[model samples]
Target chain A: MSTAVLAAPFQAVFDANSQEFSLAGVIRPRSVDEIAYSITEFRRAIDEARGVLYINVKRLAQMNNTAFHAFSRVVLDACRTRSDIRFVVVTSSVVGWTERMFHHLGKIEPQITVEVYDSKFYPGQSFVEDTSFIPILRAQTKMTWRHERTILPRHGMRPGIAMADICCGIGDFAVLAQKEFQPARIVALDHSKPSLAYARKVAAEFGVTGIEYTYGDASEMLLEDNQFDFVTCRHSLQVFNQPELLLKELYRIVKPGGRVYITNEKNSHCLGEPRAQSIQWTYNELARLLSHFEMDVELGPKSRRYLADAGFDDILVESFMITNLDGDPQDFADVIAGWEKMFAAMAARHGEAPKFIDRFRQGFRDHIFAALHPKGYAGWPIWAASGRKPL
Target chain B: MNAAQRQPAEAKFEPLLQFEMEMGTFLSDWHHCDQLSNFMARMISHNRTDPVRHSNFFSSALNELLEVSFRGGSPEGRIGCSVFRQGPKERVRLSFPCSPTQRRFFGEAVARTHKGDAYARYLDAISTDLAPSREIVLLDLAINFDAEIRLEEDDPPSISIIVDLPLEGIVS
Candidate 1:
């Protein structure tokens, strides 16, 4: 009866009446002890999830506040009670929380693993993460039915085939592959030993059987020559200094009649002669390299090029905008603020060049974050194109 | 396996021999190891501690880390620690097999003379290299300190004893 002392200010946000909401943003803690306490609360939230919630955190060391400890414990408790609670927490800048979360989840839901993302998109949106990143990225990532709804529309997973994922960062795509079609053999390979080790442990815990998490430079593993079927790469084509070597590696590894899929993010707003030339150097060069792989290449728009370039048949590109601003000036201003800081960061890094900076600013104005708030500019257009490696 | 090649008996580098037997390998390149980080270089040393007849209360606790670092990873990696002493702090190094462990794992350097200077003599004669690995990974033990955990090597084994946390014996 006298539980007012137990009540917290953030507890007000956990309206029992509100069916479900995403905890997509950052909540910094004040102390390390507080960090321990918050983990307990998030556990409660996962246990009692009226619906699935996405936690927006970067790393564990960054999480030191007492309030954050209470918050995390609530979320975790909620995950335990609810069956649909898919703990899709991104672990990059946050290590301690991830460590604790992994320790607990590794013991409990080892079968139902956590999905880790590189967080390449929304690089400068940490402040907005509080109310936005979790939900928007979930809808964007399609934790609910993202794979069945989007990827299924393009590349149909028939059942019983080894799906090779090159540069498998923290096992996101592999988790998706296991959940949906239950691919017979999933060869997930990455260069990072720690990443591979964690992925191996997660895969083992999550009961992702028949999936082998291996360590090697995808383009240069010292294994068999042509040893995979349906090789796939996502959002990592641009990072490699030598895209042609990777493409050649793909050509050599992918079986006859097997397909190769590659995806690279192309910023719609960032373009001009000099800027276009840079994109040409990075993004365009990969496409140019893909053209050399004996298979017929079909380059779809930015969103759909990965599956398409692999020579998948019937390639289609669909563009979706993240525009969901509810007339709240501050909210929209936050989105606008998010964009301003974003462009400022880019401008600072590259310099105040017209085509690169101005064009991107206009795109931000026309379609990326604030102006496209209605569609959630969470994405300008998500590319999806299917190409079949000629059987 | 040759007793003649081991520590305390070998007189030439006898101190260094006694040091190596206790500390395992001398990480000459310990400073370059990736397991630990830069800031830790100033703190924890990997040499042997001084032989001041530590009470059974302390030696019993100090032995846990001795077996783990050496036997936990590989046989070649297995290390047994030699104890040392100062007023509040102690140092122990994991010297290589066949090398004596006069090197300091903790406390201060050994001094050349001790006329009436015990601490200075301890620092000069006992301690080995101070500036080793700069890396300080929480999971690393090649250089950085490890809590002494007494356990049988059984998978996620069970801990039978715990080393005295400096806090317990320090304040009281």
Candidate 2:
């Protein structure tokens, strides 16, 4: 929810260039000016965190040392000027050569805070994994951007607690959770063998032993009730056949003071009529489910109202927008148009994804082109909702 | 175990030798820009191992892979690299990347390096021992950097390079 809150003022509300499906939540900004406004709002939000920064160091190789050291000077200045600027080196690597070099490079800039925010791609993935564009447009994504995502990070996560990532695909959240909280125990839950295998390789490579890998249906894991300090459900919740039952399960495992977190497609349409009805139904059931059990829930963008109805007193919502758009939209569109195709191509011997994504390619382009003339493609929805289970 | 002893039996090492895969179109781009000044200040010892993959004169098994990348528009191949006991498990972390290459170079400098257990086999063996716990971070950077290289429908997305520095840096 913090992300939504932090990014809403900064996130582009609509896009004019889109020509694909323009469902409500997927609405696009009619002009670049609208997006520019959102980007400014985002920058202001980022600036709110004293001593925090948003660095654009994509081409590390070509980046000049003068500019490199110049940024370090600002970081150092933040440390010198602000007492809370005690953090240092937000690196993506455990001890990446980049971080190592930064350590030596910034040695001249004393009082500098550095933190490495590396892409902890679950267990077996890399920060620089697949970047082919075709599959990007093929994803069946429906995440939304909400206005109240800033409550938590501003509040900051509860320190010294463990995190449990249910259905931890490729261990992305597991790595992020470890980075965010430095949680003593990061229990990664998943069922697929290959996914589990991939997760295992990642956990090992990044030396994230703090995480314990568990393979199984997360809803059925033999974990203790109220065992987790924080529970996060990423893109996995919407796919559940029984979302309400799972919410109850999530509520049950979170300790009284702990938080239950869920994020979903952030499109505005997801918040609309019948589809919203399904969401409302989930929330309503959560309310009924919790009242019977004497538990309170929080409803962020990801939650159903039933959570608030179920007696969650303090609720929060937010958004996180990473301005990285290098992935292939066609690939993404194909994944959404047809998931099985990518699955088959993944195990293909050669670059055989084209075969599976072939037919959908024209449709994907046609859809985007279609959206552009009409209004724009559907805006992927991403909603985040969280609430505390009262102690 | 010593390098010779650690060597996987032929059956075991066969799979290791045939290991390889390239990502996206980075290889073709990298090949074209191979002479571009190395980015990081440190000298990275990156060597494009033989056959460029499974196809080189080294083996017939690669026959399947060669038909793929050359004919197929995708990046694909199976090349092999390995790890083994170059140091005690504790000290192994530090010596890991270097020791294996040294073990290969130490046995024989050039020409015959890929010959037998002394060189090729040793490289594969070392990769096995270094059960390094890997970590991956999936970043959905909103902009496609490759758009700078290749674009489909429109102009590539431009990354706004904003360098935030307080105005006081100039006055001081």
Looking at chain B only, the TM-scores across the models are 0.26, 0.16
TM for every model, in the order presented, reads: 0.34, 0.34
CA lDDT of A316 in candidate 1? 43
Q: Clash number for model 2?
A: 130
Give the clash count for each candidate.
129, 130
Candidate 2: list runs displaced more than 4 Å.
A1-156, A266-302, A309-311, A319-363, A366-378, B1-172
User: DockQ for each of the predicted structures, in order?
Assistant: 0.01, 0.01
Per-residue alpha-carbon lDDT of candidate 2 for residues B9-118, written as tens digits (9 for 90 to 100): 32232211112234233245422111111111001111111011101111111111121112222233221122111111100000111223333332232223223333
Model 1 regions more than 4 Å off: A1-140, A143-150, A153-156, A192-210, A269-347, A353-379, B1-172
Candidate 2 per-residue lDDT, tens place, A117-201, comes to: 4343232122113334223321332111122223335322555776677766566556655665577656666544355556567
lDDT of 1 by residue, A43-155 (tens): 54455554445554332222212233244344444446565646554443112234333333323443234544443332222322233232332233333234334554355
